[model samples]
Target chain A: MKNLQIFCVIGSLFVLTACRKRLDSFLFNNDNSIIEYKLDSYGGELALDIPIDYLVPNNDIHLFEYQIEDEGEDLNISAIFVGDLNKISSDTVILYCHGNKDHMDHYWPRQKLLSHLGEQGRFGVLMFDYPGYGLSEGEPTEQNMYESTNGAMKWLKNNGLSDDRLVIYGYSLGSAPATKSVGDQSFVLSPSKLILEAPFASSSVMVQDASILNMPASYFVNTKIENAEQIKKCEVPFYWLHGINDDFLSIESHGRTVYKNHSESWKQKNEVPGANHSDVPTFMGLEVYSDSILSFITK
Target chain B: MVLVVGISACGPAKFVEPLKKFENAIAIDVGGPMVTIPDVASMPIPFSSITYGHGWSDKLTLHGSWYTTAAIFGVAQIGAGATYGVWKSKRQKHGISAMLGFNTAFDVYEKNFKFWPQLDAHYYFKYNYKGEQQEDLLTKNGRKRSNLLYVGVGTWYELEGVKAHGEKQQDIVVPMLNIGHDLNWKKWTLKTEVKLIAPFSSNENIVLDYVSLTGDKGSTGVYLGLIRKF
Candidate 1:
């Protein structure tokens, strides 16, 4: 019995170490580093691609960094803008918030695909790496995600893009910042429309789904990214896209609930057949996916 | 005590048959519902519990358990229960037993608490070795050898009236149907069980893909237990 008590104490301490920082850590898969933004030359496991004709000129891509204050720490966030920087004032810009995977390089192909939404370079695309992802400094946290995305928005606002032309797009983990920006009004500029692809309902929903019980999200993680409730406060037109076969985030629970809770505006949802979480854009056929976005934003 | 309510029940069935009066036992159990890992195969969530049981009478046994996995996750979950033998027939080698239990969990970080009430009833058939086989199976301590097969239905009742997002709680009672086998050895019993947990609840919307025999409802849970008698 004495040995058992000692084992319990030691085991509890060891497991407790593994239990903390769940939300901040689990949501971000940003540990891998890239020497450069290789784009098509990345030669990684990316399934999505940008055709040669649609690819932007070398000069059209601008790689830069900006600073942001994240809960008392200064973080340098890396970003890339594809399209003529001078055209920001006249052209509609899609502020693409990438998923919680590796750095900006991993999602460059998707953003490049978005750059050809209606026509080649028809819309300027801005993509950024949240702190702790890619070359950005500091660690990944929910606050850092919001602030890093906000820094990108502020940069666009300063460089002549207006809210009327600013469209925000989030995929998977990126949905937290995109939804919170529009819902909470915490960012420098409001987007004309909001797009979320494979967004989870909330952290609570994740745990509840895992345990098959109404377990509190706080018990497992401290992330309060409740896109379902946040969507209620968003008055802008909401565009939701999810894969019917998304195994990472369920379309029925995560995406559908967020869609159902968008009570304030003209909302549209596209459930692409046979698409999984990361493969939605590729599976939907880039042409069809682009057409859908073009119609939603143009409307 | 926090927002979400009535999340779980005690681990496995405490007793399928009443222990002899004054017998004490300790058991360790491991298992949980199976979930699919996207492109990966479906597997059970590993949950573990340790239990101690005492026989108060020939027909009744009391038991308590500490959820080791929940503790590892920083939730202090504990459960207590009593099993009462409702009917038995030595000649028929079959018996019925009922269990009433409760499980409570506390989040050590947030200091939040939750409680769930549970009930289970099972019918068990005992098969004893005959003649030479029975003599060969008998231990030096004169312990009898037998194998037991059981089928049971269990429920865990959630007390909270509403869900976490203030949605109406449609599933107040979670039901499970279980089938198991117990192999009684000299000083230890091995228990293996398969359960259909929350068969009435829809398994579709949730993030994890559950292994369910019932098309789109509920999930399958598997448990293994080792009990030592003293």
Candidate 2:
């Protein structure tokens, strides 16, 4: 019996170790630097090289690199400021939370599009990389993401950006922190408006959708971000945009669920008929996409 | 992060089956795979199994068993197999059995199936009584009234069918050492086994490459069951 007990203890430890290792596998990170771009004037024709920066002139945008002290760790955060620095105090700022993928560099084009929303240079767009993404420091976790977002929000507040002049825009993975900030009272100030594009409903819903299985999320993961539950408490005007043919996260399961959960009286949804995930902007065309967002923010 | 926790909690591997069968008896085993270390922790998954055996002749028996675990996160498993036993003792006591079986683990979207072929050999030692030594410990009514202890060794080979994304078919061989006790009282018999299974070959790392965890090279587990003789 004693020998059996000894053996059992050893076995249990082995299983726990394996579980810890398994936990580390969910995060996929890459450290490739953001691509560089150069501009040159040509014979009376202004030609931009990259597809992303077509509308936004290079001189109007500034890239800011700052350090955020989170949980005793100093993490590097990369952000872009679009519009004049002097107008930051007076203009409504859009806190753009981007989706998961390579890093902030990948979403630089989206930031350019957002800068022109509601008339040219009318809104100042602030977009940054979450920790462990882009040139940011530390691995991405729920707690770290929240902390990083809070740090960015605080920096904006300290620089004369107030709650009434702020609009939160979350895309894909960015929706977690965006909804969390409004839903959980994580931030001291509430934004004027909330926008979710291709938002996932929650971790459980995501697992079920991805695996097409009836298994509970708890069996495999402990990350529970219930966007539907959080959106219920949002009091600001809510605008949701989703592609009808999004294969990664289904429109019915995720986008619609979150929209239905919001209790805000002023809530709207735009389901692009032929668009899929990640191509809504290109599919809607710059005119329609920009006009829709401009109208939503102005209204 | 939530992703880390999500990856850590997935997967259930096959457990050792101590090859013990009674002639002309039906047994049900109610237990699950367990891992020991720091403290004993079972898989926390629910499982039940039933086995039946019939004596074909004095030295031969045919048996079959089916086992299944309840679904968690849409994950469930069912296994069924047949065993051919050859008794060495004249009374059909000590024997070796060869088994062929297939099992499947599935979720709502994906299914994984495996074929298992195993060979188990055991020697039973009956209790010594004060007076008469009965080779066949059965009463006039055909009820068993003896206790037996057995030690066995088994080897199993498994080939799995790949169905999940990023998963590939795996072939694994496991060698196991088991000690068991069979208690017989009237129409009811109880069997319990302690098994130590050594991992001969496994592709757990390749299969769970997205996660950092891997299976142990060797592990100890236990199985307890009840058998009814007709």
The top-ranked prediction according to TM-score is 1
Expressed as tens digits, the lDDT of each residue in A215-239 for candidate 2 is 3454344556678788988888899
Could you report the Cα RMSD, in angstroms, for every candidate shown? 4.4, 15.0
Per prediction, fnat is 0.23, 0.06
Where does candidate 1 stray beyond 4 Å?
A1-24, A30-33, A47-52, A69-73, A271-285, B1-10, B36-42, B129-137, B141-144, B199-205, B212-217
Model 2 misplaced stretches (Cα beyond 4 Å): A1-14, A22-53, A211-214, B1-230
After TM-score superposition, the amount by which residue A249's alpha carbon in candidate 2 deviates from its true location, in angstroms, is: 1.2
Score residue B157 of candidate 1 by CA lDDT.
83
- What DockQ results do all the predictions give, each relative to the true complex? 0.25, 0.06
Q: Per the 3 Å backbone cut-off, how many clashing residue pairs does candidate 2 have?
A: 16
Best by DockQ: 1
lDDT of 2 at B202: 27
Interface RMSD of 2: 12.3
lDDT of 1 by residue, B113-163 (tens): 878888999999888744215565455453657778999999888788766
lDDT of 2 by residue, B1-230 (tens): 12311111111111122233344666667543343211333331224554556655434455554442223333343444455543445554444544455444443333433344556566665553211145354354434565667776765554434422212323344566667777666556677776655433321211111211125333444566776666
